[model samples]
Target: MDWKDAIIAVFAILLLLSIATTYLVYHQQQQTIEVQEAIIEEFISARHIHIETTDSAEPPAFVDRYGRVSSSIVNIIAIRSDTGLGEIGRVLIEITEGDGDVLVNTEPFIKPLVQYSVREAVEVAANFTGTNVSKSDITVSFEINGTVIGGPSAGAAIAVAIIAAMEGEQVRHDVAITGTIEEGGYIGQVAGVFEKAVAAEKGEITIFLVPCGQKQAIYYERQTEEIEIFGFTFTLAYYTPREVDLGEYMAGKMDVIEVATIGEAV
Candidate 1:
């Protein structure tokens, strides 16, 4: 081939490579973002979600690459007790509405990630709740386990929901968190609190939010490990599991308050 033609071919090849590289790099980054967001969204929604639209002088901007957004919401899980006979009762979580303008949308490109369900509390309660030798005499209280990573941790999200309901403020995405909330409203430690904290730091979160009471321990542990708190503010508060009413929590009528005990939330 002529020298001129050969030079042109090389340039064309170089241009194609540049375009392909850019596409691949962007695609990979997008895939990573999608994966992480899915993990967070699934865990939150798997509990209960409350989306609320508030009348504000100025609405909040969209938090992500998604479209212009306004609104805030809480993801929650509800548990019921028939007779205070055991550890917990039946637990149910649904996505409802919350206060504020948090954008809600569906993406057609993302696939749902497969997650493990928390081992039912019933399996753990067989030893605690049997009344008589007869099978019918046995009663069981439903409980949820969220500390087991890769499994559902609606328990933690439920605590946040209760907190939001009491405080009357929507928990936004700006804060990253993870934890397990017990029936007593105590923020129980989880397997990945530190890892999740690191992840949030990597995301440039200004505030590291988690189930309350875990802050001192997490902060202390991070300090010993030489991990920086990343200039993020940490707020920890209890979620009233029992006294916190899901119905009212969803309605946006509840006050933004801290829950002292899970028993009080119900």
Candidate 2:
């Protein structure tokens, strides 16, 4: 072959070799990336899903509004020096589908640790109903009209709300409840049953439920008298020695049902 032709042939061979080398490099890189992706997916699949406690301070668990339930709190009776006997306060509870933790947020209310423990007890009850509470986060909120909700009186009402939210049931608006919830799902006696019952009736609640055996309630009557001292009037308050049994007193006003457990209350 001629020298010029020979040189041209060598150049063509080199060009072909370069093209093949480039193709192989590109193909090998693509394969490496594919293998890396598969390994990553396998690792992800093998990793177990674990639940970590939420952010700083263990903020309350939260649920979405996709499903919701609510319950009415019985009114509590409070005695004021100026006023003798009257229905004073009530509490309202709302629940929704949670995303495994439970957060009970109270607005202008009370119950402290009693309410928290009550929520935990309710969780147990809800789980017994086949609800995957761990897979859900529940939020319980209490609404009151500038009234403080002290003690564990909201146990029964809160339980019903949690169950209704998980099961998507309806809670009667005219029904009110008060009682302390124990860890075993049994309810305990609460204070101020008469006041709570009276408040429920005042709110037009038709069904009022209290803890069983809490048939007697003590309404502490107080007498206040104003006395003039150095141009300023002073008032003194004292409790009266009168205690009344609530079983009969409540019988005539509303449908009072005595429940021993959350299952019975529901």
Candidate 3:
């Protein structure tokens, strides 16, 4: 074959090989995407838990006497297995006249601390509203949307909801709270304040209430430094926790208020 013909044959072969390789790569990518989607679907189906919803037609047992009240609460998902970042979920409280029992409905069970928080919330609410908690029953429900929640951080919000129910008052939908309920109706500090605040802001909460001294969030700032030892330079990295006022940080976004007690929050 002539030199020109040989060159032309080689180019044609190379072009055909390139096209085959591209098609194979494209097919493999499509297969990978399909497998990923299937895995996600399976994961969701397996981990899915049923959340009970109140029917409008059928009135809740609490509506007759002590009115049902609900407040939004922010909780942190420390491990972002489902979502890439931290997410917040809602807590719904329903109170009625019963045997002072605190009931919770959630998937995969609930933490003992969460149950204790509900009891504390009941006490705090009773003190605030001057009602006999022994004559009432509280049912706390959680809505899980790609987030697993279990903590005492929602104690303040539960107390607020119970108090509102006892007083026949409604809580502001635009407000959310995160803190632990303590004796004397005081709110205690909890972790993940900053992460919870960001989630609350994204949820369109206008007013976010936190514990007394939690108005500022402590975050670790990464610092890198180079040190020379024995004519050799080494790089070191460290994190320093710095406090940032949550209120000031979220100024135009939302209002972050610090409440020492449930009464102040109410």
Candidate 4:
């Protein structure tokens, strides 16, 4: 029709196109936001899922329980590899949900034993608490504060910590134990009971638990005898077992109690 009419018609079409493009872009952005929100929700839900044991198809009652737990700093007595003397060391045990991993921040030589101890600790803890955790993913992490040779002597302490963690209880900071963990929640005897007791006392642990019948520490005393044979002098050196009564020795310093099982120690 007329030139002005034609210009107005073109302007109207351009405005409509611009509005349509803006609507499309806004709609796509809204969809993307929805997708991101869904993903975030799913991830959070997955994290909260309770780990289950293989013994039963139903989840345990403690599901989503104990997201993270840390035990009181344990006063562990270890012998120095170079000095061959008992040293007081500190270790903190942390338990969390993981793919059945044992993390040790100590010498590599003790990794395998620590792993075994963790597994046993878990088993013992589950049985003690009447729960099943064999198939549940768990991570046991150890943080050591001093340089000392590692061994299974800390098994009892580890088991005790695990039980406390699972039950949402706190282990007394003034108490410590030294022994190997055995089946049926028993505490197996370990060496260096006297040395460990001394270390525990130094670390301000008022109550120290040792394996059964270990309240008396047995040490060896060096004995030397010299004799002359065929105009030649010979010297013989031997060691004799000597016992020290821990109760009398540490009478006022700390109380050294003998424990037969992890339950008793706990």
Candidate 5:
């Protein structure tokens, strides 16, 4: 081969090696990202709760409709750390896809339509509750943008907030409650009940409400004080009181009312 031709061949080989090295580095980075995503997915799946989308027939289902509004109450569920924070982390929200009419409707653009609806629901619920703002002014407005929400666990607190807004009463900024609001207005129980209760106590909450099943968490929290133990199981337990027991607690200190509907919030 000629001298110039040999030099050209050497340059070509070096260029190919550089390209190969770049490709390998890029591939490794992609794999790292995928592994991190899988880890997050696993964690979220284990901690997440599945909430079914509301029936399509429920008009004014999104919070913005202007009709004389009725309310649903529910208990909040899921897990929390003992660090006295109320932020929900790494939540996985999925929409119901069983009905083709709902999600897979044949219209050319309806897939985006259904997807938008689901996104709206997730945004309203997750964004609103994730913050420290009062639930009273946290109005969840919806549009034709196609949104739905589930996990009815936040219904009770939402109902209480809504009732306060409707009646022109003030909700204490220092207090928080958890429970599912059923269509009939009964508050249901939730998991991680103790963690949330303990958080409320640590925050010096003036009042906290929970379903009957979780009353024990409160009873124990009221009696606890800071201890210098290295590591121990934090037990938040309480005895279930009789139906009238809550009424007595309500008279003084902090009120824990068990009402079947938003109408009974006072």
Candidate 6:
């Protein structure tokens, strides 16, 4: 081939290479931006940040991450005896670094079942969740306002919060989770599914975590309506077990994520 023809072919190949390189670079940048946005979104959603939205208003203050949750509170959904309906119960926790002795409030006010659950939570978080807390100098204290909340169901949330607080990791604030943390680190399922869902919704929780197999269930509710009549009044009520997807229940409201282990949860 002539030198001129050969040089033209080389230039064409070079031009094609340059175009491919430019396209690849642009694609990679887009992917990087997407990943960064996902991280920020995860961080923000985890904390359930509440902010006002307006065209003229500034965005809500957001920190990259958070450290050990102090007074890290989680809600427990329970059935109210009086109303025979679901209600939201609160659990408040405070953890402090101490001198190697894990202290928990086993007070008389605290139910015996909850006391056991709390201790189990401390042990699981310390040993399983990759948290390196000085067991010799840490204290865990919690206050329970509702009696209906019992069993190891709260173990997962309690353990993770303690670990997060000690490790200075951020616990998603907008999410509420329910499950019992097994001694072996398996997240065990708990009862009160219907009531818990109701309670979670009432609390305005955006994400609700449940154990595997517990993802799909039935929730029954009864409503009473009064009708005025010509000479009297009629009251009508109905109840049924509505089939629903745990993640898309409540009229496809909040997210109900099913987690099987501590790793998935964290």
Q: Which has the greatest TM-score?
A: 4
TM-score for every candidate vs. truth? Answer: 0.28, 0.59, 0.64, 0.66, 0.35, 0.58
Error of 5 at 36 (Å): 25
Q: Residue-wise lDDT of candidate 5 within 4-96, one digit each (tens)? A: 677678868998999999999999998986786567545533442233344454322223344333222222222323333342211111122
Best by lDDT: 3
Instruction: Write candidate 4's Cα lDDT for 55-96 as tens digits.
Output: 555544344555444344455666666755667655555555
The 0-to-1 C-alpha lDDT of every candidate, in the order given, reads 0.34, 0.60, 0.71, 0.69, 0.42, 0.62
Candidate 1 ranges beyond 4 A from true positions = 1-149, 152-154, 162-168, 210-266
lDDT of 3 by residue, 54-79 (tens): 33443333346345443333232232
**Residue pairs whose backbone atoms clash in candidate 2:** 63-98, 75-196, 77-195, 98-137, 99-137, 100-136, 100-137
Better of 3 and 4 by TM-score: 4
Ranked candidates, highest TM-score first: 4, 3, 2, 6, 5, 1
What lDDT score is found at residue 97 in candidate 1?
26
Clashing residue pairs, backbone N/CA/C < 3 A, model 4: none
**Model 6, span 1-266: residue lDDT tens:** 98767766886899899999999999999898678656754553343211222332221111112323244556555545555565655555555433334455543144345555666676676665444344223444444444444355677877767666555455776677788887766888877776787778878878888888887866676788998644447688988667667665665677888899877887
Which 10 consecutive positions of candidate 1 have the poorest summed lDDT?
A: 131-140
Which 10 consecutive residues of model 5 have the lowest summed lDDT?
Answer: 88-97
TM-score for predicted model 4 compared with the true structure: 0.66
Q: Give the CA lDDT, 0 to 100, for residue 96 in model 3.
A: 64
Better of 1 and 3 by lDDT: 3
